[model samples]
Target: MSSFLIICKSIHLGNTLKIANEMAKILECKVLEPEKVEAEDIEEAEVIGLGSGIYYGRHHTSIFKLLDKYSFKGKRVFVFYTSAFRKVKFLNGCEDKLLNKLRKHGAEIIGVFQCRGESRLLGGVCKGRPDERDLARAREFAEKLKKKFS
Candidate 1:
């Protein structure tokens, strides 16, 4: 089984990390915090998974910095993000940016997995409730990713 390195970073909540952990367990991938991993560490893994909590329509700074510092040459990279907005347009072009960055370093971009969670603010989707269905969908997404990449 080829090993993978999963890194999750968030600003307010760690839902993305939790989901990534679950997927790592099933995929037999090694999970690490973005702050604890170095650029060289990423080079050793066949796959790299990045997860983050969306804030103000963007990923955390730590996640961006990790992507900026590392070269994902010849690696399979997956992206997962948790957002409250059902339709977030600001993030529309981010996947392209990430893919371009990874490709510049000779990496293969596998695709993205996203899901909706509870909204913290006064006005948003399911403000006080996180639908069980949403998490289940996240799990399903992980399963599909495992089957495809593993």
Candidate 2:
């Protein structure tokens, strides 16, 4: 079986981590914080998922830093995130930022996953999100990716 690794930075309500955990369970892989990941861990994985909670309309700065610090050249990479808003237009723009970063690092983009997350900003929005329904979808996404790539 192809090995899978997820590098994620989940803060706040741990919303992104919940989604990451679901995906990891389906992939039967380990989830590591960006800070905890080593170069060898990245080197050993056949598939790597870069995940984080959206902040200020983009991925966490630590995630961006990981992209800057490592070489993902020719690596199979997937992107995932949790955001308060799920609008197509807004999401496309948000994903574009991370996509551009991955391209610059030479990662071979494989898939993308995203979902709504509860946020306390602006009198709280999307509360109780990334709920069971979101987790089920995340698992299904991982299963499909595993089938296609593994």
Candidate 3:
């Protein structure tokens, strides 16, 4: 069986962790916070999922640090993110930023998923998000990834 690793940075409300957990459950993989992940963890993973909540239009710094600390060359990678806005334009390039970094490491990009998340800034938008619908979508995405990479 192929091994999967999901590393996520959920600094605030945990929306990113919620989505990561859903994917992990469907993929039957392990989910770890960025701080808990090590070089060996990345080395052992066949397929890696990187996730985070959009913060100031980018993934949390911790996620970037994790990427910087390890090399993902030749690994298959997928990315998922939770953000405050539903409009893709409002995402502030979070997906692209992560994707580019992964690409720079020569990782094969397999899939990307993004969904609205409740925001604490300026009141809240998409309240109660990473809701059932979002989670279901995340799980479905995971299933497709599994099939494609299996």
Candidate 4:
């Protein structure tokens, strides 16, 4: 079986995990929650997926820290995020920033995917997200990942 790893960190309802787990199943990948691993321990995978909960329009601390410690050279990397706002263009910056970072580390960026995650704060603007539609979109992205990296 091909081995892939998904590193996810979240501050809220674990939406990142939910989506990453679903994608992992599709790719037959291993689940590596960064919070539970040493920085060096996460380097064995050939392909890496980073999923994060967008905090203040950026990735959470745990993910940022892991990115700082690990280099992505010669690896296939994909980024997925759940955001509070539905502004399609607003997420472009975040995705670009992540892509830039990965590229700097010599990673082959497969793609960037985003979905609306549940937001209980601020009057529920992003409420009821990672719903069926979001899951379908994520799964589609996962299929693309399989084709590219498999």
Q: Against the true structure, whose lDDT is highest?
A: 2
lDDT of 2: 0.90
- Which runs of model 3 end up more than 4 angstroms from their true locations? none
Residue 29's lDDT within candidate 3 is 91
- After TM-score superposition, the amount by which residue 108's alpha carbon in candidate 2 deviates from its true location, in angstroms, is 1.0
Candidate 4 lDDT tens digits, 1-150: 346788888667877777888898898877676777665555677778888888876777677667678777888888998887764665546666677777887898877888888877777766677898888888888988887777
Candidate number that wins on TM-score, 2 or 3: 2
Model 2 CA deviation exceeding 4 Å by range:
90-92
Off by over 4 Å in 1: 88-94, 122-125, 128-130
Please report, in order, the local distance difference test score of every candidate based on alpha carbons.
0.70, 0.90, 0.88, 0.77
Clashing pairs in 3: none
lDDT score, residue 145, model 2?
93
**Tens-digit lDDT track of model 1 for 13-97:** 5567667767777667777878899877797787788877776566667777887787777888888777766644564543445
The residue pairs that clash in candidate 2, if any, are: none
lDDT of 1: 0.70
State the lDDT at 101 in candidate 4. 76
* Positional deviation of residue 25's Cα in model 3 after best superposition, in angstroms: 0.8
Q: Give residue 74's lDDT in candidate 2 (0 to 100).
A: 84
**lDDT of candidate 2 over 1-150, digit per residue (tens):** 789999999998999999999999989999999999899998899899999988888889998899888888888899999998874774445678888889988889999999999999767999998999999999999999999989
